[model samples]
Target chain A: MQQIDASAIDAVGIPRLLLMEHAGLAVVRAVHHLVPDPSAPLVICCGTGWNGGDGLAAARHLHERGHPLRVAVTGPLDRLREEPAAYARILRGLGVAPVECLTAEALGPLDEWLAECRLVIDALLGIGARGAVREPAASMIERINRSGKPVVAVDIPSGLDADTGRIQGVAVRATMTVTFGLAKRGCLLAEGPAHTGTLVVDPITIPRRLLETAAA
Target chain B: MSIHSSLRTPTGVTASLRNVLKRFERVRHLMTQGAWPEGRSVYGLPKIKQVKLKVRKAAAKEKEEAPAEAPATGAAPSSSSS
Candidate 1:
């Protein structure tokens, strides 16, 4: 899937940022479907990668649509990669400074914070993530699941393997998963169905032929 | 690869070969772009800059109004001391 995204960017000339935007929009739409109240508070938990980029982008859209929002990033703002960093910068420019919660100490207030949210966006991991989830992220996922709020996971649920549907230690039990492009094989097999309450396949701007090629 | 006579059932071999060819045909299309159509825009989003501006403006407005009010409440008590 990452290869297909790269091919779409390199061979098909689609900007990575545009794909992120589309992904974010798709998530916002799914959120709206689940939570119709415009003023309901939405918490988006982000990591440092492109999945976080999608959440940051969704935060902007949700904010625009009058949904109260808070962005809690797993690490320091400076640690974010390029595309996520760009969206985070823009979010800051809009005066929505994402809270950094990298340590257990920093995450101390998160459970209480999430308890009040109408919904949670789990942007902590994606298809590229592997192995067991480490600290702060692991703790954060625990907090999200415990909050008992409806969670909308971006791509696969943060801690589930995208190809095998195996849980990497603790995983977020999402109310819905807004996956990009095609649904991953993992989302359909094994523990995926139990963790992913609902699944949504959001379309990116990749050409159909490219996806067919990759699948073929 | 030579198939051993004992291992090959005539019908099974024909079916397996046909399936392999079908898969190869699909793979060939992916490897070579000659059969694919073109001219579609890969960037499908619209009014992105405008959306960003709106979000920024709204956030700035919220910041201005935040000072007059007590901190937004309803959050569970902080546990930072723990």
Candidate 2:
């Protein structure tokens, strides 16, 4: 899947930023489909990777459209990679400061946000995540599960093994999973369907040719 | 393997190798049973006992249990007579 995404970006000449934007838009669309009222509060939990960047982009879109939003990031802003950092900067410029919760102690406010919000966007982990889930993200997943708020997992649920459909230590039980490009194999594998509810596959504008070539 | 570890799904397929229920499954089961009500925290869910029912197979061997007065219908010819 990474190879296909790379080919789409590098060979097909689609800008990486465009992919992020499209993915973010797709998530927002799913959110609207679930909860049409724009004023409903929602929170996006993000990791410090492209997945987080997608969350930031979604935050921007949601904020622009006047949806009550809170964005929490797992790590410091400086540690964010280039693309995510760029989105982070844009978000900050829009006065949407993302809460950085690096430690379990810092997650207190996250609990309040989870309790207050109507939906959760789990951008904390993507298809690249493997093995047992570690701190902060693990804690966030637990909180999300306990909150009982319907969650819309970005790409795939955090802590879910995208290839094996196995739960790595713990995984978020999302009410709906809005996956981009294609449906990940893990979403259909063992214990995958139980955790992944109402799976929605949205194209992120990866060329059909690239997808076909990868499948072939 | 313990009976719990070899639990089967509704279709009679083995559910998983582990006897313990996944947290998600446990929580969902609790909710369905009304043990975990909505608005309650999901932490510290009560333990669910895995019930192992003793399935007794019905008495078998109709051929061996055939009545003494039964006709030898469709029975193979005796090789001793040949």
Candidate 3:
């Protein structure tokens, strides 16, 4: 899968930003499908990687569509990766304030956001993340799970290994998941299926040739 | 006598010896002879017994052909009669 994405970006000349833009759009589509009510409040929990960027992008689209939504960043804006950071900057430009939960203690606001939101979008982690769930994000995941609200995981559930589906500490139990390109190995193995709920594979405009090569 | 007969080919002759053994067969031979040292890597080991294969000349080829030709002639008559 890594090979395919690299080939698509480097060899095929498809922009990474374009891929991320499509991903964000796909997530918004899923949200619209599940919750038709435009006014329903939604919370998007984002990390510092491309996954977070997808969530941030989704927040922007949701905002433009006049959906009442709140976004919480697991870490500070400065810690966000280049791609996700771009989206963060765009959100700021649009005057959409995303709560930055830098420390475990700072995650207190996320509770109220999760409690009132109609649906939660989990973009805290992507396939590239490794090891166990750490502070802030860990507590945030715990809150989302305990909130009992339907969750739409962007790629794979946070804290769930993308390749092994092994939960190092805690993982979100999503009501539905919008996985990009293809279903990750973690989504089908171990406790993945149980945590994943209704799994949806969103191509997100990855080249057909690249997807076939990776599948082969 | 029995041991020599066991080595007979389908044409009723002693099986020809190969000139060389493959690397794995050489290693197995070394292991059986207790010449292979423990904890020693299998790579770049010493060569073992190598028999020089006897290249059959005109006399051997003629002998092989005589039996093969006799069987073909014999089978033809029987097959035709049947």
Q: Total clashing residue pairs per candidate?
A: 0, 0, 0
Top candidate when judged by lDDT against the true structure? 2
TM-score of each: 0.72, 0.72, 0.71
Native interface contacts retained, candidate 2: 0.00
Model 1 Cα lDDT, one tens digit per residue, A1-216: 898899889988999999999999999999999999999998999988999999999998898888877899988899888889999998888878899987867887787779779999999999999899988899999999989999999998999998777899999999999988877766765587778878787767778987776555
* True interface contacts reproduced, per candidate: 0.00, 0.00, 0.00
TM-score: model 1 vs. ground truth = 0.72
Candidate 2 lDDT, A1-216, residue by residue in tens: 788888988998998899999999999999999988899999999999888889898999999988888999999999998888888999899998898999878899988998899999999999988789988899999999999999999989999998777899999999998888767767865678788998887879999887766545
Off by over 4 Å in 3: B1-82
Q: Alpha carbon lDDT of residue A69, candidate 2?
A: 85
Clashing pairs in 1: none
Model 3 complex DockQ against the native: 0.01
CAPRI-style class, candidate 1: incorrect
lDDT for model 1? 0.82
Better structure of 1 and 2 per lDDT: 2
- Ranking of all predicted structures according to DockQ, beginning with the best and ending with the worst: 2, 1, 3
Interface RMSD of each: 12.2, 13.8, 18.6
lDDT for position A198 in model 1 = 83
Candidate 3 matches the true fold with a TM-score of 0.71
